[model samples]
Target: MRQVIVLGAGLAGSFLACRLLRQGCHVTLIDDRAPMSASRVAAGLYNVITGRFGSKTWKAETLLAELDAVLKDPFFQGVSQFIHPIHIYRPFKDVEEYNQWSGWSAEPAYHQLVKFEERPLFPEVIHNPLGGIRILPCGWVNIGGLIDRLQDIFRSNGGVVLQGSIPYDQINMGQKTLTWKGEPLGFDQMICCEGYRIRQNPWFEKLPVQPNKGEILEIESEGLDQLPFVITKKVYMVPGESGRWIVGSTYEHLFDDPGPTEAGRAQIEEQLRLVLKVPYKVVGHRAGIRPTTPNRRPILGSHPQWPFLYTLSGFGTKGMLAAPYCSRLMTAHILEGAEVPEELRITQFKAFRPT
Candidate 1:
């Protein structure tokens, strides 16, 4: 059997392990003592129209269909039919701005998403008086549950998992082997899904990884039960299953610590308080570093120096949306020797040269 060792038990790592297992490859996964990852804290909302600013992403609808297929399998534990279309309310800055956008029907992008007389998803989500626009086909994922389910599926397939970190020096490319806790393990390939930890990876350290520290808050509201959709402004309040929701995120460029900051907590709270007419209680707060590239695209490919080594990350805040399709493409490229989509190719970024 062709063996593969995967580093990092994150969303990308776990998912890749499952896919490799499905392809009948021997797989082993390693991560730190803490199993809780960034994918854990994320509210995992996927949207089509990126609202007033950004352009519509490529193949969003097709990717959504593919996601539904993979995530719907019985092996997925946290899988729920809770994937519902959300109406995003864009709080107008003023009447003048609202009128300007309303007149943008001539633009192809503006004509694609909105419709007339749409009531806001949640009544109490207060915004500017000029009302808002409705974005179609946006929804949230049970991110934590999905990660756990993937891990379970991976283990069930005879995939070995270690609780401690793997040392880079222990990896021997010439021998195609790894020494984990002083024990030798042979593998045909190794893929790193280490997220922010990729910055410390000696093999691919040269790849520009701009890790950003972000924080989020989980909250509950009695008045928010009627909210079946997501609300976004400076921050986002993504509705979760049951009566729960997540408010986030405060972006900090300098911090590496994943512990929730008082400033980040306060920023989200203040933003939430502005739109929320009803009372809500803060239940949880978490912080994690997001692995992003300068060009705002994922880094995926074999290392220039090591053909057997691969990377699969840099999905940033859109991991829930981007990973599904991107993982499939990467898996096909790795296993079937197929070509990767140009947009997602790691070579797209000039700075991603391997050592």
Candidate 2:
């Protein structure tokens, strides 16, 4: 029997397969492989300090460092070239805000990530009069490209990758067999890493998974590619290849279709124009639903009733960093009988038995 079977071959699923393979477990991945999934539509941003108040995110520093460590592993040496540790410049709204943030930036606790600056970046093309501070230990990942490359590597070693959905009704958990389109396959264990689509999986629908829809745009503009890093306010602009710049991300919790909309495009364009002074044309637009939780932490553990059945989801928008580290934790918990961190434990959800 195959040692493991993973559902939804996105970032979390891909990382889990890599981890299990490293531990000598025979593994297979399953997914429908949608091109415009969350992992593909995401800007892959890794910001430390976010939100309206500009405060640091939960354990941002530690997670950033852990991401660096994961990327340095032998398997990711030359292949994972998409992880870019670029600088993020947040322009101050006014002199008062600049003075206020500059004081906080001077504190020792903010040393690694906060850096105060006087001059602006690309003054000729940006409206950065109040100056800005650079957010260090931040960057982005080309998640779509990374996933594709990892899939190729995974398949090269006789790793099985089923390109269609599994039939839940035909799954015989008692016999440790899965029915993929009427074909039965045996596996010792199975894990579900389905992101926002987890609601479709009856076993995990009650776990408080919140779907957050996000939209981003790709614009083509000249003379701005040399800006060197990402810039932010309500929206952020990041450097892209070949004179293309990526501006993003508006979050909506009340949308119907998980597709691009005129309102979303307008919102991004209006905000992007305020901070940017350059001429540009909209080249691309995309939208995806993120799988988030109220607690803002990843949830990973086995089913209370069935030990062989497991789940791994709720990395939210920060999956780029969260998935790799949490996958390691999950691997250790599974292969070595180690305890999972309290925050990430699935038992935290009320009465997790199958319905």
Candidate 3:
């Protein structure tokens, strides 16, 4: 069997490792389990129709199908607890916006993905004066729970799991050999899925990996938990278990730190107040740095100089929606010598070219 080492145990790494294992590779997965990692803090919201204009996500159909297959894999059984299916209610800003959605919903492209609502669905708790559109096949994944289960599954299948960071300085790489901290690791290849921490990698650091910081808040309200669906406007409000609700996510392309800030909290609360009519108490606050790309596409494929070193990252806020499909592509490329699409390849960036 081919021997491989996957660095970083976030959503990207975990998915890739599982895919590689199924391909009959002996895989070793390592993670530091850092505090406030993106996967852990992410709302894990997956929606086909997103953004201010409500455009369909790129490759939504294929991505969703791959996600379904991954979730149904017998190896990942009992992961249903992390999957929460719910529609997303996007409030219309005005009559013109409502008209736009009504027109789009009639088209074959959006016939099943979206539906326009002429009357306000929840006037008592929401500020939707002009009604909204309900987006189907949208829901939130408990990323932390899913990762934990995946790790357990990996271990149960005889894959090795190491808990700790791998120092870049201690890593020694050659044309056909690799070692960590002066000890040889007899692996055929190494794939790095370190997310925003990719900046620390010497080989893949040149690729355009922008770090985007985002913050989220958890609040407790009296009857808000009764809402069985997600609400969206300037921000999203996802209802969790019990009376707790998740409200957030402000994108900061430029930030001095990655930790939660009072300013971020204030911004989240400001947006939350605009949509939520009920009073709530802030129970939790979190922040994480996402590895985003300028083109908003994931960067995959191997290094130019070192073919054995590959990278699969930069999914940004859509990691949960994209990881499953991308992992399969990475696995095929590694084992079957398949080609990665140009748009998702790391070599598309000028910095990725070999000297």
Candidate 4:
């Protein structure tokens, strides 16, 4: 059996590990954190329609089909993977931007799903000036719960998890072993799924890492209990279980600290207050850095020289949509020598080297 070691048990690592395990591979997954990752902080929104200046979501339709297929697979039964249509109310702050996306995605399937009929603003509850339309086959992921369950499933299947930091310098290519906590573990291949931390990696020193810091707040409110759906304006209000809701997220690219910032907190509150007419209490706040690449595409593939070295990260803000698809692709490339899609290949980095 081919042995694989996955570094960083984040969304990419955990999901990919599960796939590999199902394929009957011996796997060891590691992460410094106990369990939670940026995935935990994410609202896990998967939208087929996205882009600011009017660009199509990268392979969203294709990915969503795969996600739906897996959820229905007998192997995934009892996992309770639920997917639902999420209605997005994006009030066109920039009409020019809205017009730009109007003609994009000429695909027949996408065109069929487009509903030209909708209200500009919600009649009740809130206000919208620019008008909004809805997108289908999009919704949230139970990421934290998914990861926790994956951990249990992984351990039960004889998969190993070493929970602690594994320094990149400790991987001896010539020796083909990783020394973690003074224990030397050998594997056929090592795939680093470390998120923002990979920016400091020497081997991939040139991989563009635009650390986008995002903050989100969970709140409890009364009279807003009617919101069983997702709402989006400047900020979004996603319905959580009970009377709680998730309102977020402010994006700051140049921030140094990953901790929740007072400015970000205030910004979200202001946005929430504007969109939400009802009173709400801020119950929790959290933040994390999204591992965005310069090109905004996931970085995947094996090192040209060191075939044993690989990576499956850089899912960016769309990890929820990107991870599941890319994980399957990465596993296929590793196992069957399948060609990595030109779009996501790490070779897109001209300056990257295996050594």
Q: Local distance difference test, per candidate?
A: 0.74, 0.83, 0.87, 0.75
Candidates sorted on lDDT, descending: 3, 2, 4, 1
lDDT of 1 by residue, 1-355 (tens): 9899988877788778888888888999998835335676677878765644635666777777877877577655455543455766555555665566666534776576654323343454565456555566667777777777777777876888888877889989889889988899999999988887787888877777777778888898788777555777677788776667888887676875668878889888888877788888999888877777776677788887678889998877678777777777778888988887777677765655555
Cα-lDDT of candidate 3? 0.87
Candidate 2 Cα errors over 4 Å, as ranges: 353-355
Candidate 4, residues 1-355: lDDT per residue as tens digits?
8888998888899888988988999999988873225776787777766665434587767888877766777655444453445565555555664564355434575674443323454446665555555565677767777677777778888899888777687888888888887888888988888887777766665677677888999898776776545777678887765556888888778977778878999999988877777678999888987888878889997777677888888888899788878889989988888898887888888765444
lDDT of 3 at 191: 96
Off by over 4 Å in 4: 34-36, 53-55, 81-85, 92-109, 120-122, 129-131, 353-355
Which 10 consecutive positions of candidate 2 have the poorest summed lDDT? 71-80
Query: How do the residues 3-45 of candidate 3 rate in per-residue lDDT, one tens digit apiece?
Result: 9999999999998898898779999988899876799899889
Model 3 / residue 249 / CA error / Å: 0.7
Q: Model 2: how far is 22 from its true place, Å?
A: 1.4
Q: lDDT tens digits, residues 1-355, model 2? A: 3479988898999888877876778888989987656787888888888877888888776787778877777765444587788899999988888988888898887888888888876788888987888998888778888888777777765577888875677778889888777678888888999888877886777777788999999998886867777898778988764466789988887888788889999999999989888799999998988888989898899887778888889988789878878888888888887998888889888867445
Which ranges of candidate 1 are over 4 A from the true structure? Answer: 33-36, 51-54, 72-78, 81-86, 100-125, 349-355
How much does each candidate deviate from the true structure in C-alpha RMSD?
A: 2.8, 1.8, 1.4, 2.7
Candidate 4 TM-score versus the reference: 0.90
User: C-alpha displacement of 99 in model 2, angstroms?
Assistant: 2.5
In model 2, what is the error at residue 40, expressed in angstroms? Answer: 1.1
TM-scores of the candidates are: 0.89, 0.95, 0.97, 0.90
Off by over 4 Å in 3: 175-183
